[model samples]
Target: MPVTLRPLRVAAAQAESVAGDLDANVATAVHLVSAAADWGARVVVLPELFLTGYSPQAWLPELTTTPDDPRLEPLASAARERAVVVVAGAAVRRSGPDGSAQRFTLSLLVVDEAGEVTAPYDKQHLFDTERAFFAPGAQGASIVVDGWELGLGVCYDGCFPEHARAAAEDGARAYLCPSAYVAGSEHRRDLYYAARALDNGIYVVFAGLTGRCGGLDFSGGSAVYDPEGRALGRAGIISPAAVVADLDPVEVARVQAENPIARDRLGSLGGRSRVVVAGPRP
Candidate 1:
């Protein structure tokens, strides 16, 4: 006989954040986490810089969060209570290249089902404007949830094919992208997610921010793309919503077997990008 388990359901979420208001934003995040779990999702990903609302205000010293920051405790508790893994975004501090001062890194903090958080997975690729505000992370990262090895990346990180390819080379079955796209930039999200999924034969989940933040407006385009670059699920534009989908390991294996991209690839030519894995989630 064979052992059987529950289906692997995951969700991508978007919410309108209260700029620079940690209390309100954290509450909204917790609510969304609960909503995802209630929908039978075992893992959930939220938009980038959600805690500080992706505003210019993110550069402020008060907006930085650490893995164990008390402000995120409620969110960890929510994941623990719901028995789901929550990949959430925040502005976290990291030593500057000069090592003289601390700067921010757009990062994802993984909250395991036990309410413990793994160290932040900072964004590896920073957009043009972001390069001035944040220091790019040194490498890629992945986290395990209920035995699924999922890759991690922030907004612009997905734009680079090497980022996702490295994760696939490092054995990630799914890529969780927490992103934010301004009003007219929605098309970029679709193209990148689909490209990444097809290029690496891996599932891609996108969580985008919605509504106004600072002087800009964002259109939520949360979606999930299967290994063949097909849209498996999608959330409405510019409104708070969660895109939920059931990930099938068998389907992933089938795609990889048929495509052989991972096997025939010229030996991880994506250059020195190392992928760090977080673990076997309970």
Candidate 2:
């Protein structure tokens, strides 16, 4: 018998984070996750560093937490109660090589419906300003939910085609970018995200932080794109919002079969290339 592909309802949330407030931010994330679940979203993605405002300058150290921190339990509980996958951001602390001083990395925490949290997926690409505080992650990361492979990326990572390409090569049918882009940049970012989807033949979901944080206003253009690079759903750039869309794996398969960009690369290059690690995934 042939297999059937089910549609996966996914959501992207655009909201501001309170700087240096873990409890309040976690509460907000839980609320957003619950709201998405209410809307029948199987997977809800929040903005980058939503748990601790995207203030890399001052709040980086203040907001850093270990993966097993007790404060994160509320999010896990909410995921279990909603029976949905919750992806949120935070600063994760890890010891340096050979037990050196602790280092922080911008990361996403994936909480399953069973309340089990996966290891932190760090952001490999750092924006110019972010490098001063957080260390870059080591590799790319993806999670399989309901037999769908969903890849993860942070703000600036979405700007790099190689980042999404690496995930696509790793069998990701969709790429989720949790970002904190400032106001006035939404238009360019939207085009970039669409191109990423078109080039990879995979769904692209962008969740951006909105409102003001640390004296900077954010652009809230949260959106979901289909494999054809069409906007399935999108939120405005002015306020906190959520965009939900259904992703069908069958559509991805159909697009890949028709376009064949992912598979045609080697033959197009005359089979003279070898793959190399573009960057790190944590």
Candidate 3:
């Protein structure tokens, strides 16, 4: 049998989020997922909050969906039929105290080729202004599809090293980020991704939303980075298109072995921990 994950075709769907239009958004997502599968992508990543767009605070209540809501079934169906893994975003509803529902800008799910939800990781870090309307999620997870273990992060979660580190430590060979990074935040799309890839010794795939949402201009620099901090390719700052790349696990391992920044440091941590705590604490 051929190596299913040795060279995986991955696509990043960089599309505009239709503000507060769940039906239209779902249609667009399904269309993109089909397009990705046609392009021979085994995995496809969508933008953060794509299902309901990056709606402002006022629209949060309208976009909430419980975990068992049927809205997610469509995406799962698409994944099963397409024989691809999808990581998409939504404004997910969570159980609050007293039976109230809490809303979050969550990366709602993971659907495999068998249409099963093998992993689900919500957005743990809410962006500025988002905290006013959304609650943070505590989910941390990774999914294995076709022998490739993938770590999923949504939007702001990409900025934190700990989130990426946790994912890397948990056996994620690739990190998939679905984002809605805005205009003034282009540096992270440019600089941070390379740094994270170098630091984690894994492939970093970022998919972002373009165009305006609630008056904020988005800069969609959807991209992929190799373990050596090389930019494979990227979408334009305002373009709505799909960016695809053939990922190789061998190349990922080769890059890390040659550089060995994160790997070396991680090895030393065990010994360093002994020295740091060698003395008694007061």
Worst 10 residues of 2 by lDDT: 265-274
Clashes of 2: 5
lDDT of 1: 0.85
lDDT, candidate 1, 1-282, per-residue tens? 755433489999998987788778889999999988889989989999888778876567777777867888899899989999888888887665897888778888888899998655889888877777778888889987666778999989899998998888898889999998998877777899899999988899999998888877888889999999999878867456999999888888889999987678785467586686877789
Compared with the true structure, all predictions reach lDDT values of 0.85, 0.87, 0.78
Better of 1 and 3 by TM-score: 1
Tens-place lDDT digits, model 2, residues 1-282: 865668899999877788778898888898889889989999999999888788755445656877678898999899999999988888888886888798888899888999887655899988888888888999899998888889999988989999999999999999999888888987787898899999999999999899888878888889999998998888877455799999998899999999989877763435466788686878
Report the lDDT tens digits of candidate 3 across residue range 58-168.
Answer: 356766655466766777789989899888777766656877755554655667787775337778888877787677777778877677788888877878887887888
Q: After superposition, which runs of candidate 1 have C-alpha atoms over 4 Å from their true positions?
A: 1-7, 95-101, 267-282
Query: Candidate 3, after superposition: displacement of residue 193 in Å?
Result: 1.4
Q: Which candidate achieves the best lDDT against the true structure?
A: 2
Error of 3 at 109 (Å): 2.1
Clashing residue pairs in candidate 1 (N, C-alpha, C atoms within 3 angstroms): none
